[model samples]
Target: MAWVTWRQHRPQLVAAAGLLFALAAAALGTRIPIEAAFHRESLAACLPPAARTGCDIIVPHFEAEFGGLVTSVRVLTVLPVLAGLFVGAPLLARELELGTYRFAWTQGVTRRRWLLSKTALLAAATVIAGAAASAIVMWWRAPYDILEGRISPSSFDIEGLVVPAYALFALVLGVLAGLVFRRTVAAMTATLLAFGATRFLVTEFVRPHFLAPLHRVVLATDSGRGPGDWVLSDTLVDGGGRQITAAREDLAVTHAQLAGIDPHTYIVTLGWKRLIAYQPAGRFWDFQLLEAGLFVGLAALIVLVTVWLVRRTAT
Candidate 1:
């Protein structure tokens, strides 16, 4: 059974290997050095003693070089969906459509065993391929992830890898579609639609709202402050004891008004930056394990459907 399975799906295995190789090559080519961007030793020397300041100098920008590679790994988003359509969509559909299952069924192999063996073999292959793709993406994104605050506990806990469990789910979905529809083309189309809808809903709607809470903050500044309010780059700060809008051109009138309001009296102002904090409401492993389990459970449900349909119709 193992040899037969390998022989039948060798092309997919080769394709998986090729995709992993391409990802690995891209990762190595696009990596940026985080150490140089963040820990500059000469920044103090360039600044005047009076201008010395304390600030959160996260890493220098590395997103430009790594953005393309990050997007490339997102290809995995559609890979499992396509794989299932190509492999699982036709597994039972084509055989039944062409009346070839009759020959195999009469050859002493039970329909249940045949379906189980094929799904088992294909699932294992799909899982391995997906895992390899996820690992490559994880490794390549590690450096920038650290500097960009992306490797935080929350991101790591949520749906991070685009492989293994996700791919398995897609493959099973394809198999179920093929068995239920009993037509390869129809099954493929249905599988693609199902996969696209599931992915879009989960990513765009569900993930962000899962246990996330919202809050609002109010900032009240002194009347003598240069500006009533200001919004700057998240990285910019008044670390040098200067106002937030000290260099901005739009605040000229505001600055002049403030100067007249308090040349003799100094006014201290407060600026508020509203940010959502999604600290894990509980243990980290719980969410990670939950996400993995949910997807895998969906995959198992699809497999059951595939088994049931194959048994009923593939005879």
Candidate 2:
């Protein structure tokens, strides 16, 4: 079964390897200039808590120069879904679609064993590939991570246990889709759509609440945001402690200009405050584990369902 799995999926395995190598090389190649500029600007002196020391010009300039390249790298999040589309979706679907399952399933091997053998081999491969790609990306992104924050969507999706976990889940989802649809292309399509929707749901609605976000009030001028903090909302409230009305907002700006003061300072003088909701940087790892565990658990359930279906499949 092991040998057969390797022989049948050799092309996919080779493609995955080549893709990973290309990604690693590209990352390393790009890192040279990014790191060089980071040091050239002496931006280390601009690190948080003292970010105001001398960062007024260099930091923004640095980010503006390299921000597009860094942002483009976020598309690597698609790496995990490729496993589902190519490897897992076609695993059983191709055999079943071409009526080769009769020969494959009846070759003295039980369907469950055959399924487990193929699934296990490919599952492990996807997990390793996803993790390797993630580690490489993380290494490349560290300089920017130091400047920005990893909890942001662009960074969070690609830099932790969750990447491998997403790969595993995507693989199983593709396998399940293939088993149900019995057509490689349809299964692949379904896997892509489902995986994308699930990712969107989790990222937008579920992740922020993984642990209750901390809510606090601070002067608008202060911002009170530490480096790496994931601030959800920063709203300006009036002296009456309500969200500032539009007319009042205009008045505040006008008052600030008349008084020759910054709007934030004027707002503070009026006893207005900012209500902030944020997830601290310290919760990064905790959020990673929570999200990873969620996906891994879902994958385990999928494997169980796939096994049950395969066990009752007619040879």
For each candidate, the alpha-carbon lDDT, in order, equals 0.58, 0.89
Q: Write the per-residue lDDT of candidate 2 for residues 84-108, one digit (tens) a residue.
A: 9999899889988999998888888
Per-residue accuracy of model 1 over 1-315 as CA lDDT, tens digit each: 678667767877788788778867876765545334433533323222324444223112344544565555555556667677877787777877788778766667688887888889898888877777667666665554443333233234222444577788888888788777889899999989998888677645554444443322223232221111111112212324333454442354366466775421222232322222242323233444555567788889887777776666724
Q: Candidate 2 regions off by >4 Å?
A: 221-225, 239-241, 244-269
* Reference-based TM-score of each model: 0.68, 0.90
Residue pairs clashing, model 2? none
- Determine which window of 10 residues in candidate 2 has minimal summed lDDT: 48-57
Model 1: what TM-score? Answer: 0.68
Best by the TM-score measure? 2
How many residue pairs clash in all the candidates, one count each?
Answer: 0, 0
